[model samples]
Target chain A: MIDAKHLTKTYGTKTAVDDLTFTVRPGQVTGFLGPNGAGKSTTMRMILGLDAPTSGTVTVAGQPYRDHPRPLQVVGALLEARAIHTSRTAYHHLLALATTHGIGAERVRQVLEQVGLTEVASKRAGGFSLGMGQRLGIATALLADPETLILDEPVNGLDPEGIRWIRDLLKGFAAEGRTVLVSSHLMSEMAVTAEHVLVLGRGRLLADLPMSELLAQAASDVVLVRTPGADELGKALAGIGATVSRTDVDALEVTGPSAGRIGDLARDLGISIHGLVPKQVSLEEAFMDMTRDDVEFHASAGSAA
Target chain B: MSALETQAGATVPAPRAAPAGPAGPARLAVRSHPVSTRRVLLSEWVKFRSLRSTAWTLLAAVVLMIGIGWLAGWGSNDSWAELSPQEQATFSPVDITLAGYYLAQLAVSVLGVLLVTGEYATGMVRATFAAVPRRLPVLWAKAALFAGVTFTLMLLAALLSFVGGQQLLGEHSATLGEAGSVRGIVGVACYLTVVGVLAVALGFLIRSTAGGVATMCGLLLVLPTLGLLLPSSWQEHVLPYLPSNAGAAFFSAAPSADSLSATAGAAVLGGWLLVTGVAAAVTLTRRDV
Candidate 1:
């Protein structure tokens, strides 16, 4: 388990992580959701003891990361994809890290194979493509088979296959009772992979909720209704306390009432109902609604387009 | 055999593995054991050898040492023989062993600086600190690793330069077993290693690859060259403290009038190394990784 209490980090006059208090429990994948420059990297760095926290403490298994006897064996992290010397071969890079913990060369070979990097283990990392480099980074993180894994943007440059592979690998890892914290800006990906989520906006926690609860608490689930007599249908739906939005001359997007109920109401009013379709709430829409007021840099470009 | 063994396996309990930390059933054991310096040294040794740059730099330093000594032996024969009796009187066989020390020192110092500063330059220092989060162990390991490799290479370079210089000198040369000659060669090697370590310490303090290299080169080469341009009084007062000047004293069979006494140079070099080492340790421990 990883725990942080009142953790804060600041650079000059700007705060990067403000009063972050959360526990990342084992046996599940916790998705850290945030936009770019929203403190995910800073928090990870602090946990690794790469950066000093301005205030508060963070610990892994009740001991600070710096104090852990065997850090690599306890916590495996990939905070940056290219956090290695570009000139070194993948095998040598992992070997160096493995040697630090008195781990044998066999473990390095196993992880290289585990990450599907054995074929390119002898190649210089600088020559690898971005996706390939990310694979090497993941291999280094798994070198010691640590109990906890923290990945930052692991799927940023991966192919569809690689993405699915990571999802399955993370699921399997968590199933073995290890803590996995994956950070991403993509809501759709996190919605499917994350069992629990910690959402951040403007360097502060906006919501810490389960994935199922987040998907369920979407603003409203709408149903599209097409009717021949829209005025009469609107009156009937309004009378039943259903909110309706006009889409066209004969279509209305109705919320707060089920499709079946709306159809019965229209029939009772003698209005011909043509279309009644339920609108599924996408995770992107739900995420936007949850973080709408807290987004640090709202995409004004979207509105302009 | 299998039937009876399988029956025993089903009835008898297997030895359970040791429990891990309370984070729950961890796939890997939580190594809560205390860290030892041996582990740190092993880690550093692996880090040093894994990089191709380390090999290249060491190769360059050895080549520079042997190449410069051979060239000086062949080219300076006439100059040595043609020297006035007064100048010829000052020549020593040990000087030939160290003919390449000045040039090779530059490469060795660069190696030392790059040892630590490359991590800082590429932001790989973060990865290093994460691996050894106490931070001091990383610095200590780096210093020990650099010192160990440099000392080995410097000793080899000294031996090669001496043998090759004697081959060029022919009848004029002295052997390693000659009185005081062995001390001179070993002393030169020791001096070079000390200067290299000083560069490593400076690299940690500066934390920039180019800046550390520049500072080391300036200290090892530039300061002594500038000392030549100064008046004899100022030169005598300042030259002993310069790394290069003090180091050259170790190669000389007899101390020059303007240079520090051989014993004095040893003391001064020790002082310089001590100050640099302490500053490096303090800065590394106190600063953010």
Candidate 2:
């Protein structure tokens, strides 16, 4: 378990993480979601004690990470993909890290095989592709079989198989009762992998709840009605306390009302409906809405669309 | 104590048995073991040999030291034969074995600078400090490793160079018991190792590979050059205090015309090492990696 209380890190006049308070529980994959510069990386760094908090405390399990006995065993982290010397082979890098904890070389080989890096274990890590580097990073994170694993952008450059492999791996780790806090900007991946989300925008917590709650809190139960009298149907739906928006010249999205209700309203108004169907907001759309104000760099088209 | 919070839609696997103890969150004990200096030393040694750079540099220092001395002694036979009485009186056969100290110090200094500076360059300092957060232990371990390696290699290099250079000297070899001769040759090895570590401490304080290497070389080579151009009063006051200047005393039995006493030079070198080590520790512990 990781608990960050009022975690604030400021660099000069820019606040990277602003009074961020959240708890990452064990036996789950908690996704740390944010757009660029939303303090996701900074938060992870502070959790690992790589960066000192300006005026707050973050602890892994109970005590600070640096204070933990056998830190690698307690909280293994892969903050950077290549947080290793390029000259060292993957085998030696894992060996050196394992040596600190008195973890034997067998564990190193096991992790290498787990990550499908056994064949290339003797090769220099500098020659690894971005996907291979991610695997190595995961290998390092799993070196001590750490209880609390913190991986930042673990799937940034992976292929489809690599992505699936990581998803399954994190799931397996969390299933083993390990606390897994993974930070990534890939919402699609997060949708499929994250059990909970700690959403951030402009360095402040926008939402911290179950993914279900976030998706549910978003405008839901959307009904699409296509009719010759779309404007009339929208007016009729609005009068019935449903929020309506024009999606197209002949189509209107009606929320807070089921398709049955919208169809009933259209039938009562004697408007022949070509289509009436319920629409569920995609996780991508719900994520966008949740982080609308929090996104650091809001591209005009993405926001406007 | 462990809470498993799962997002909607994303299927979370059930919690498996904890690796060691309970099924829920496992809190770390508040108590911590006292930091062991020996463990830190062992860790530093592991880090030192794990890198190819360290191995190659150590090899270069020994090989270059012995190789250069052998060549200088062997190649200078004609010059030694033709020397006038004045030159002959000043030229000691043992002195020829110390010729490689100049080149060996450069290799050792480069190696020393890289030892500390490489951490900063590769951003491994974060991982290092995370593993050993007290900070001082890390620096201390590294210092011990650098000093130990350089000293051992220098001692070996001195022995090899002396043997090789003596072979070139043929019948002109100086005996090991000769006054000041034996001390000078062994002193060169020990002295160069000390300077190498002094360079490492400087590297730690600077934390930039190029800057550390440049500053070390500048102190050893550049400042002495500029000092030579200075007036007698300034040169005498400043030159003896520089690390290389003070360190040069270890290479000689006869004192320079206006050099510091050997004891004073040793003290000066120790002072530089202390200052650099302290300053590096302060910055390392205080700064966020």
Candidate 3:
């Protein structure tokens, strides 16, 4: 388990992570969601004790990470940046880290096989492709079979198959009662992989809840009513305290009422309703809505178009 | 094996024996032990030997020391007959035999700087520190490993150069039993070892490879030359205290008039090592990796 309280990190006058307090429990995957420059990497660094927090404390497995007798056995982290020396081969890189905790070379070979890097284990890491580099990073993280695993942007350069494999791997880790915290900017990926999420924006906790609750919150009740007499139905719906906007000549998008109620009202109004479809809000759109005001860089609408 | 075949056929790069099922934690059979100084030293040894740069740099240092010492001996012998009485009187065979250290120090110091700066350049320090989060052990281990290797190999080089160069010197050769000859031979190796440690400290203080190399060269080579522009009185007081100048006093068979004694020179070099080492330790434990 990982627990952080009042965590804050600042450089000069710019604050990266501010007042973050949360607990990542075992037996489930927690997704750390944030846009670029939103301090996900910095927070992870603090948790690993690679960076000292400007204020507050973060601990893994009941104490600060540095205090653990065997930190590799307690927590294994794959940082966002490639941490392996480019000049060393994959095998040697793993061996060097493993030797610190007296972990044997057999364990090194096991992780290499687990990450499917056994074929290129002898090759220098400088020559590996982006996907291969990510594989090596994962292999290093899994070297000690720690109780908690923290990976930053593990899917950044993975193919679809690799992405699926990582999803299964994380789920399996959680299923085995280990704490897994994975960070990603893409909410769609998290929709399938994460059971709980902690969203950050402008270095503040924007949302900390279960995935099911977040999806349900994003699920809107707006229904689309298509009828030849859309104008008449729109006036009747607006009079009953429902907001109605004409999307097309014969379609009325009605909010604040269910599809059944809207259909019943249309029949009561003597309008010939051809279709009534409720729009399903995607988690991507919901994420955009939640973080729209907190996004650091706003691409102009015209430029995006 | 069937799973591997199917994965290869399907072009899925990662395929395990089975997906880590919920049967139990994906635990390996490896035993865990606390990180100790010995294990960290072993880890550093692995790191030091794994790089091609380490072997190449050490090789260059050994070849330059022994090869150039032999060449200097041959050159001095060829010019011995043409030398004036005064020039011939001041000539020391021990100095000619150890002349290779002048060039060999560059190779040793560069390797020292690269040993630390290389990790920063490649982002590997993060992994290194994460594994051994106390952080100071790594600094000490690197210094220990580099010093050990450099002293052993350079001592061998010094001995080989002394024997070979003395052979070339013919009748002008100085034996190991001669006064100050043994000290000069062993002192040269100690001088190079301390130089390597200074470079290692600078590598940690300045984490960039270029900056570390430039600063190391500036202190060991450029600063001494720049001191030559000073007035004679000031030069005696100042030039003798510089790193290279102080290091040269103990390793020279005949201590120069303005330089410190052999014991004092070693103390001065130790002073340099102590100051830089403390500063490096402070910054390393305090700074964000």
Candidate 4:
């Protein structure tokens, strides 16, 4: 488990991660979600003790990451920035890190195989493509078989196949009872993989909820009606606390009411409908629906937004 | 993709293997071992040896040392006939054997600085600090490993240069058994090694290649040249105390009256290194990556 209590990091006049308090539990994959410049990397760095937090603390498994007997063994982190010397071969790079915790060369080879990097184990990392580099980073993270895993955008540069592989690997690691915290800006992928999500907006915790609850929150029935006289129909059907938005010149979208009610209201109003279709809210829309209010809330409070 | 063929779950993947439960794999220990100093030292050594830059840089240092020493010896012997009796009398074979340091120190110092600052340039410092969160052990291990490697290689180079240059000098050659000959060879190695360690310290303190190298030059090279602008009395008192000059005193068999003694030279260099080392440790520990 990883616990961060009031973690804050400020750079000069800017606060990167401000008052972030959350606990990432074990035996599940916890997704760290945020927009660009939301301080996901800064928070992860503080967790690993690379960057000192301006205030508060982060601890993995009860103590600070630095206090662990074998830090890598306790938590393995794949930070966003590449932390490697380009000149060294992939194998030697892992070996160098492994040796630090008294881990042997044998473990290095195994991780190389696990990450599908054994083919280029002896090649200089400088020549590796972005996908290959991500694999190498993942291999480095798993070298010690740490109990907790923190990955930042682990699929950022991976190909379709590689992305699928990492998705499974993370799931498998979490299944084995490791604390897995992976950060990403995309909500679609997290909808498929994450059990619980901790979302941030402007360095503050916006949402900490289970994935099912998040999806259900965004699952209210919203129907679309395509008609030429959208203003009259919108005015007629928008009563009773329902919201009607004109998506196109002739299309009006209705929410906060059932499709049958909207059809009956449209029929009673004598508004001939060319198309009345129920729209399924996608994960991406759900994400935008959830964060749009959070963003507006910040904008209304802070002048900088 | 093969990975997508067996879908575990829409929200969370199912367990592909049995629960790890602290007995994950054979390689993973049930309880973790502490990060010992010995392992950190080993890690540092592995890092030092893994790079091709290490090999090339060391080769450059050796080449410069042997080439300069031989060239200096050869040029002196070739011009002996044209020199006056006074000029010939002042020529010291031991000095000629150690003359390579003027160029060799540059290569050694650059490598030392790169050993630390390269991590910052490549973003590897995060990985390093994460592995050893205490941080100081890493700095110590790197400095120790670098200094030890430099000293060993430089000592061998100095000895080779002396033996080879002496053979070329013929009648003007000084044997290892001769007075000050062995001391000069060893002293040159010590001076170069200390310069390297000092460069590593400066690298950590500065944390940038351009800044580290510029500061090193300002201290070791430019400071000595700037000293010439002072009065002769002050120059004698001050120039010999500069890092490069003080180190030179340790190897100069025929020292000028104003120059410091060998022991004093070592002490001054030691003092400088000690201050820089502490400053480096402090800056590294306190600063954010």
RMSD of each: 7.6, 6.3, 2.8, 5.0
Predicted candidate 3 versus true structure: per-residue lDDT over B30-137, tens digit per residue: 688999888899999888889998999999999999999999888888889998997788888998889999989999989999999999999999999999999999
Q: Write one digit per residue (lDDT tens) for candidate 4, span B1-289.
A: 1332111111212113322333455434433358988899999888889999989999999999998999888888778798899878778898897799888898888899999998888878888888889899988988889889988999999999999998888888889999989999999999898889898998898888888888877887789889999999789878988988888778888776677888999899899899999999998888987
Query: What does fnat come to for each candidate?
Result: 0.36, 0.19, 0.66, 0.49
Interface root-mean-square deviation, each candidate:
12.0, 9.1, 3.7, 7.4
What does TM-score give for chain A of every model? 0.95, 0.92, 0.96, 0.89
Tell me the spans in candidate 3 whose CA falls farther than 4 Å from its real position: A301-305, B1-13, B17-19, B24-26
lDDT of each: 0.79, 0.78, 0.89, 0.83
DockQ, candidate 2, comes to 0.22
Task: List the candidates ranked by TM-score, beginning with the highest.
Answer: 3, 4, 2, 1
Model 1, total clashes: 0
Residue-wise C-alpha lDDT for candidate 4, range A1-305, written one tens digit per residue: 99999999999988888899999998889999877777888899999999999999999999999898799988888895478888888888888888888888888887777776666788877777677777788878887888898899988977666777777777877877779999998998898879999988768888899988988877757888898779888988766778889999999889877878877877888877889888888887877766674452354545545
Off by over 4 Å in 4: A227-232, A238-241, A245-250, A267-274, A289-305, B1-32
Better-scoring candidate (DockQ), 2 or 4: 4
TM-score per candidate: 0.87, 0.88, 0.95, 0.91
User: Which candidate leads the pack in DockQ?
Assistant: 3
Off by over 4 Å in 1: A231-245, A254-265, A298-305, B1-35, B84-86, B121-123, B170-180, B226-236, B254-256
lDDT-best of 3 and 4: 3
Better of 2 and 4 by TM-score: 4
Query: How would you encode candidate 1's per-residue C-alpha lDDT over A193-261 as one tens digit per residue?
Result: 899999987678878888888878763569998888888888778888989888899999988899889
Which RMSD does model 2 reach against the true structure? 6.3
Better of 1 and 2 by lDDT: 1
Query: Measured by TM-score, how close is model 3 to the native structure?
Result: 0.95
